[model samples]
Target: MPLPYFGLRARISLAVMLATLLATVSMAFAAYRLQADETRNRFELAARTSFESDLKQALYQIQYGPVTDPATALTAYMTREQGISWALLDFTSGGRPPDLWEGGYRVDAVVRRDDTPPVTLPEELVDYARRSYPEPVGKLDVDGYLVYFGAATDSLVLVEFYNMGGLNAELAKLRWSLAAIALVVSTAGVATALFAAKRIQRPVHAVATAARLLGEGELSTRVPVRGRDELADLAVSFNAMAGQVGHSISELQAKDRQQRRFIDDVAHDLRTPIAAMVAVVDSLDTADAEVRSRSARLLTAQTRRLARLVEDLLEMSRFDAGVADFRTEPVDLAALVTDALELSAPSADVELRVHGDVTLTGDPRRLHTVARNLLINAIGHGAEPITVTIDGSRPESVTLRVADSGPGIPDELLPLLFDRFVRGDRARQATEGSGLGLAIADQNARLHGAKIVAANDGGAVFTVTVPRGVTTTG
Candidate 1:
């Protein structure tokens, strides 16, 4: 039969209980069989010892001893063995079956015990002896009673029946006792199985409940570890997984907040330039030549500043969209840096040095943008003397470092230095620059399979190492 619905604990407990019950019952059954067989053997042996010798003596007197009647001698033996219900048979017609009697064979009875009723020999027992056994067999289990037959002479066979109601009652009581013990042992086993199942499933259930809670947005839910076992290892692994999930989600949330701030900063910066351009346009209505030229120049500068912010935003969007393709080709890294310096800060006090192979295969446009942005960031935020070094000393990489003797980055902003819209001096005018310079530089360096990091060693030092496999070049 199929069992009812059950959880893991119930299933485990039920399985163990069934196994225990089966084993206990099987062992009890085996013990009962062995004990019952031994007791029956001893019963038959005692029956033989008590009656076989005397039965032989009665037959000898009837056949060859004193001139005594066969019935009288046999009757005397039956009366002597009291308390044992027995029967004697006299096979007539020379012990042959053809004229023995109807119903296979029939024997003349000699039950001479007058104190009790006469015992009738079983018809099936008589027939069995007529066919297979010419003489009485030692013992015969006839109809659950212990019966014995012995042939004292060719024509005279002695039969005995054991009154086993008392002994049968005792054996019945023993069977019940063994069954009771089996039931007790099986019940105990079931109880122990239930306890063990609970012990194992408790922690597993805790982990499952905690996982459900975690999925429902209780990110801090955790299970307590118990002993040193596989379950404890499961708890440790689950806690580790929960920790990593929490960390990744926290990072994503922070990045989301930063993106919102970037949009706000973009809107605020755009407003300023637009407002300045509108004022400059109103000023352009003046009649004086110098003032009109000055307004025109002011308008152009604000427009260019707005254009650069828009361009940086578009570039960052491309990176976020995973579509910024780098068209790589052979380029002189040192010359690119020099060109960027002359373009972005021609008159700024800066030191430049190139060492080892300064040639690499990369997109010249993006490289130029990276070099230009770093130099601009240094000039705008850091104090002189700014030092730019391109060191291709490593076999498979070239390092570019830009160091400026400026106040180092604030401790609060170091971890998020490469994030978008983060400025060195927040109070600086948006007209001075957009804060996407370093962020864009970092994106470009990473896109080119390069590593760029900013740190402070006596000043703000920005280092970028781009892989080139360069050994030597001019």
Candidate 2:
């Protein structure tokens, strides 16, 4: 199977279990080899010590007691030992074997056959013993038996053969015991690894579940933090990010609803003027001269109102799309204000005042539009005695303030003054001019890195501040 198909817990458990099993098997195998070598060395040393002791006793009996034949004494000693068999060769008597000993003794039924006599030690072993006779004791293998050789006297050598089936059986038992122990240790290790994996996987599983819920638009979903670790920190961060995303989505949805309402209002405003022009179109052709002139004038006024509304809508769209173009130049603020006032030509009772002369870098045409809109709005809603003030005393910036003598703006309307299509009151809403005048002025000021703020000290005051050495053209 692919490794990814496994869960985190299973993968971690498998990794830990494999590591434990590998270490256990390595140590077990190493211990088994060490134990086998030690067991073999111990068995060999015990056998050699027994053979040397038996030979020394036989030599003492020959020197101090009434023992005439050393070969007979060693033969009697070998027959008395149950698991040991021996052979005595007399090299002093021209290589003749001793009496009462028939060839070699067989230690097992497999080596001793009824169909034939037991096989004796070959001549190779006898010659080896004679050639290396001066050595006191040594070990060799004759047929299937393990033999230990000891030189009892100058002319006599005693060779003892031991049964190896018992040593082999003991070693086999040790191997089986070690294998069983390793199996038990490996099983216990896997269980421990699984328990550890579960502890680690709990937090991870919670995070995955929360993430899945978030993808399905459940932004409030969060994982619980239990400890001061990286996983707990991850849970905290995820919850914080989810909250931010939910708030942003809520704000965007509110803006979308406001935009839809604005589009509906634009459609309603255009319908009124177009309907009025359509109703007066045929009246101009059917009436007398005087009546026809009135009809033509009325139609011309509605047509101009519709055209202005459409132009304002188009300009708002350009500003919203960040595509409004500009041409930068130095323009005199005092001259621009005077030209706007002459163009508007308000009633004679309204007073006009020019305070200071200031020259700044900006788009002249757009700045003129700003001044004209502020003047027209003040004249329409504000009282007479309008005062226009310019202050360029600051080295880095300039300000233009237009204040009128009237009741100040409503407290609720002040906050939303620059919003598109927002009028001060119901009476002002019915006046001539689209409601986008203040909004257009606000956008134009922003394009030049400026700000327009509305407040009331004596009456309504609109202040436009433009930064020095700035251009709107990009």
Candidate 3:
């Protein structure tokens, strides 16, 4: 079968099972070969030792004349050793001498055709024995029997053959037993591999399912952490990513809602001025001189208000599109504040305080706008004695604070203080100042790499902080 068609669990299980089978089969084959070699060596050694001992005794008896006939004594000795057959060749006269004695032992009596014996020495073995007189102790293979040869005297040779039929039968049985064992072990190994693979597959499947849900826009989907492993770490990282994605989606939705509200408010604000101008247009053409002058004044006021609102909206749009131009230069901040205060010309009843001085690199026009907005916002919403503080004590930055003595901004409005069209209250909405003042000031401050913060310390305080050597082009 193609590999990719298999699931992860099945693939893992197959791999483990194959490895186990290979190892088990290799080890079993090696062990069987080693045991077979050891058994063969042990049997050969024992047979050779017994044959040598019996040959030595027969040779001693022949040399000392214990029974007079050497051949007859050797034949009688061979009969007593079971599972061993022997043949004695007397080469005293030389040149293919007849074997004086042949096999009397029977390894398989029932399989034999006659009492003459089933095994007989081959000519090749006899020739080898005759040629190997100086080193007469050697082994030979006759059919399937293991034969050991030894020199009894200078011209007499003793050849003994051992039957290996029983050893062969035992080895065949062991081979079949090993085959059965391998089959059983392989089956068990496959089962164990499957069990282990299942344990690992569950968590992987959960992660896959969670990923699918996340792909389908379920940002809250998460995998349950099961253990302390790399998979668990992956699950944790996925959860963190999902949370970040959810938060980012929420933020985008909020911005979308805020944009809708801003458009609606802009439409409402524009309609008010347009309605007034439309009502006054007909009156100016047919009314008396006194009424015409009053209507004209009203028309001009509404036109100025409309123009201011359009300008503020355009500036805000430039800031939003990140395309506002900044023409920067070094300007004295104290002088800038003084100029803005003079331009505002607050009522004599309201006290004004100024302190400290600092020079900063920024666009004078934008900085003037920021100062004017902050001063106007303070004068319009706050009570008398508006204090403007210029703190440049630090070498790296400058601070311009506009504070007023009034019942500071409401707690709920502080967060939205810099938002466009946000007024202090319904009462403040009736005032002439456009609510875009603070929002514009905030955007301009950001353009100069500065930030404006609002807080209540005795009253509403708006602080503008510009970093040292700020680039205005940003």
Candidate 4:
């Protein structure tokens, strides 16, 4: 799968954090290395200086050893600085121990002193002096110290060692301070990343959510433009696009409905005249044939139904074209229901009962159509005894309900009832009809600023609710 590109906020934030972290860590490491090198250099210098001082004093005193004290000089030198340790050795032998010295700090040694039994310092310190100062042999850094003694004279060589505790402590403090600074910098970077990320992602996220809603069939949802920035401009453009899409969809649907209604209307309207002409001709040409008379009657009956279908389709077209002029006036809904009941077949008596005195601001012709179509649909598809209830005293609106006691509309047809040319029975059989009655009714109702919905309550019920006194132009 391809990776989704997160908006600039995330990208910028990530870049900043990475750059900051890398720089901080790099600087931290550099600081540590520099400090360590300096500390090491300083420690080495101090140790060498102490050793040289001790050695110089020891050599001068050793030359006059028969009368001078070299121990005091060694003690005084070691006391002046913290990082040094020292020892002294007197050798009386004519030749130095060959195996006793190797480097700055000797590893093994023995000393021979006169008048005081043999006193030996650490052999390692002595070896360090001999190897480090190979040229003179008497001046060498052993045990981190410079040594001063003579081979010809019985002399004591002083070795000095430097203390590292204070230096180590100072290095540790520097390292911790650097670490703390790095931590602070890292925290600040994270905070800055969070703030910048939100600012950049919020508007993009809004657009994304709006797009999702549109995809899910909510054409009304739109991203609100909040700024003059690019994202805001994108949102404004999106809203405009959505509006155009909605308008286009509506126009296409209206055209499709008008075309279907036109076909149904032509078929119905032509059938009536054709049947009348056929009847007149058959009566004149075949008066003696009874079968011919019966055929004529059937044709006439079908023709009348067709004419009504065609008339309904034409009316629907007028509404779709925005030319169906509506007369806004107070209509006695009770009287209209009575007229509808009279128009329906008597066998549907129980299915079409009218009740209540509901008045609405609408065109009487269109409201009557709405009532007639709803009743016809109920009676034709439902079991007899449909109950028509009118409640005009609603706090916000008036409701006219026509419910049938027949089998409730199938779940599938409920949503499409107001669609053009859809009949409940035809839908069940996967068949088609002129399919304009309910659609025409819905359009007419909406034209009068009213709304209609379909449901089932022990039967299928179509509820037409009109906002009181509200009238809409065709």
Candidate 5:
């Protein structure tokens, strides 16, 4: 089984913060241990020094001469050491201490007899002191604390009691300080971890947001690039990817729309020809010689229309597939527009309006094909008095504007007028157009790095913008 995945920022921040916390805890524990050991060492040294000095002084007093009372001397020495209590026993002597005077106030002391059985130190003392100290020492349990001290002699042993109260107070202060430091350190560590994680996570978050938008079909949304690092590279790559995907999808949609239009136009164009052919054949079968001759002509006319539609479809397909070629030449736009107008005069009721003279280098045949398609579409769909213009002189370029006074196209259908095999609904159901005239015109215009646009404010006007290129431009 796979382990569940966590976010990058959270995982990094948590791991770093936890490691820092653990290290701090380990250091704090080590410091506490060292401080405790130091405190114990200091107390042990003081105890050892006091025991050696005080006991030596008492023993020296006896060695010099007969000491008056050793127990009294030991107690007086211990009482001076503040909080230090001691007990001393003389294993040999059995007598009461001589009276000592403090300004006429007599102090009494008790001494154990030398012949009395000696008090045996506890076994815990023997074991602990033997392990903890090289010197002869004793630890007697007093309340809850173990008092550590040395015993000088079997006959006259001197031991000091260590007060646990002071040690406990010091340890409590240490713990409180450690706790405060840990809290401060932990807070700082967390803040630092969050700050670092945000710094690293910001770019990733932006990328994610952009991705979501892109998934929702917003191809233009892009991540804001920051540093010159991997994240910036990712943003750049993502933008490029979005552009390619958007372009491909747009192209596919356009192709699909074109295909649907092609099917509709083919069906509409075929219907009239097929219906006329049926009518003509019926007439030929039943009519006399003159009627049969007329029907044969009608049949030929419908066959020509069908043939024209098929040829247009094939030519448009060739252009779409990039197989169409241009035969380039130097062409005079002034004469070209005039000739195109004269040739279209037979079909068009509108008179061509001449404009400024222009000349260009181009393929005359393809350019003528573009002009014929435009003029034919205008005459076929529009009313009388169509206007055609030619502009550009020294640059050898041409601009043709064809306008008519017919009922203008609807604003809704104007955008799709140049698409393959698209015709007005009324025209598709009633008129006799192949619907490929404007489509072919638009394609030919694009073949020369040109474009065509339609407008119908007062009447329908089509403009074909083209450059005078000797070699067919894209």
Candidate 6:
């Protein structure tokens, strides 16, 4: 199964702290083991050396001196070693130790250099030593924690006991010290883990908080980037996302405002045509023939203007709703531009420049609308020299540019030139039609997998880039 889940900081702190604890404990355990073993080895070495030396001396005395002088070697040993207590067993009668210590022939008196109270060795222990005759056997006495080792020959056996309680107490202190050291180090590890986690978590927490604020309508929220790492990259990405979102929202809001203003303007424009048509209808009963004929013409003009406005409104709705479609077909680019010039601005002082046999696949009607709108905009807002260029030079795409030599588009309005109802030079846009022609043209360009870019090069320049080369079935 997967490990349990927790917060990032907690998980980080816990993992680091656990690793630290494990490493510290492993070191401490190894150190304690080595020290404890060394302490035990030191005590054991002392016992082994003293016992081997005294036993060797007693053996020498038995081999060289009179046999009755065996006690001399042991007494001399008791006088030499400070902490060692010696016991001698005589197996000449080939039996266990004597039950009595007072003048017993088989078991000699226990000899010690110190005046401490004596402990009689257990009978079972003595019997075990008798069975393990030659080899030295160690036993720990519980009362004084005396460590005993016995050695034997054919007749005489030497047993020695040394109290290890003081040494053992020192070892206990050492063990506690090690445990305390381990604990202190583990606590330090926890602190270090927390410190590290805080450094890492701070950036993440900032991003989280910023995201929350952004969601709550604080579009200006951004994260601070600190380092060239993954976390910093996340912060940078988040800040970029926030910026994009803010830009998109600002655009949406501007579009909404424009849409609202367009609606209001359309409503105001509707009354003029409708009132004129109603007046024409009201004058039908008048008998003056010239007045009736002029009223009839007024009615017809108002009716046509209203119909055109309604059609423009419907087209705008289609574009906004994303239902306007572009059906691709083989199109003659230069011929379409020439037709648009004649239909939209035939009488204007405009030049039509067709470059090569410009044939491409595109939506003819939409492409024509793009040309028609650019021509209309130029004639309405531009001056003497109007030029439309149909450039099919690039193998991958068809380019159309409609430029006019007039007082150029205002710098403030250039960015939003194609936004619906965004009319600059109020006198120029005072036509009786819906102000959605340029916006529709822009949308149609995008629908055809292209874009309309507007700039001011001496005057207003509108360039329509229609992507081609990639063949389409329909």
Candidate 5 ranges beyond 4 A from true positions = 1-6, 18-258, 278-287, 338-344, 347-357, 394-396, 405-413, 422-431, 456-459, 470-473
Compared with the true structure, all predictions reach lDDT values of 0.78, 0.76, 0.78, 0.67, 0.69, 0.77
Q: Per-residue lDDT tens digits of candidate 2, residues 1-474?
A: 765588888889999899989988998899889998898888888877877777777677666656577666655655566545665556566555443224443222222212222234444454565576445465665544567765666667676666666777888998899889988999998999999899788888888888888889887787888788887898788788778877887778877876887898798788888888888887878849987888899999999999989999999999878899888889887888778888874452444454444888888888888988888888787877888888888877778898888787889998888988888665356587678999999999988888789999898999998876776632
* Per-model C-alpha RMSD: 5.0, 6.7, 5.0, 16.0, 11.4, 5.5
lDDT of 6 at 91: 56
Cα deviation at 117, candidate 3, in Å, is 10
Q: TM-score order of candidates, best first? A: 1, 3, 6, 2, 5, 4
Candidate 5, residue 220: lDDT? 81
lDDT string for model 1 (154-247, tens) is 5556776665555678789889999999999998999999998999899999999999998887889888998889999999999998988888
lDDT (Cα, 0-100) at 170 in candidate 2 = 87
Angstrom error of the Cα, residue 140, model 6: value is 4.1
Candidate 4 lDDT over 320-421, as tens digits, reads 578887777888887887787787655565433343447767788888888887887776677667788878666556688888887787888877778765
lDDT of 2: 0.76
Which digits, one per residue and each the tens of the lDDT, describe model 3 over residues 241-349?
A: 8888889988999989989989998998899899999999989887489989999999999999999999999998888788898888898888888888788754524
Give the per-residue lDDT digits (tens) of candidate 5, residues 81-165.
Answer: 5544544533335744222243221212222222222233454454344354335665544553334444333335454454555
Worst 10 residues of 4 by lDDT: 110-119
What's the TM-score of each model vs. the native?
Answer: 0.80, 0.67, 0.79, 0.45, 0.54, 0.77
TM-score of 4: 0.45
Cα lDDT of candidate 3 equals 0.78
The top-ranked prediction according to TM-score is: 1
The C-alpha local distance difference test score for the whole of candidate 4 amounts to: 0.67
Enumerate clash totals for all models, in the order shown.
0, 0, 1, 29, 7, 0
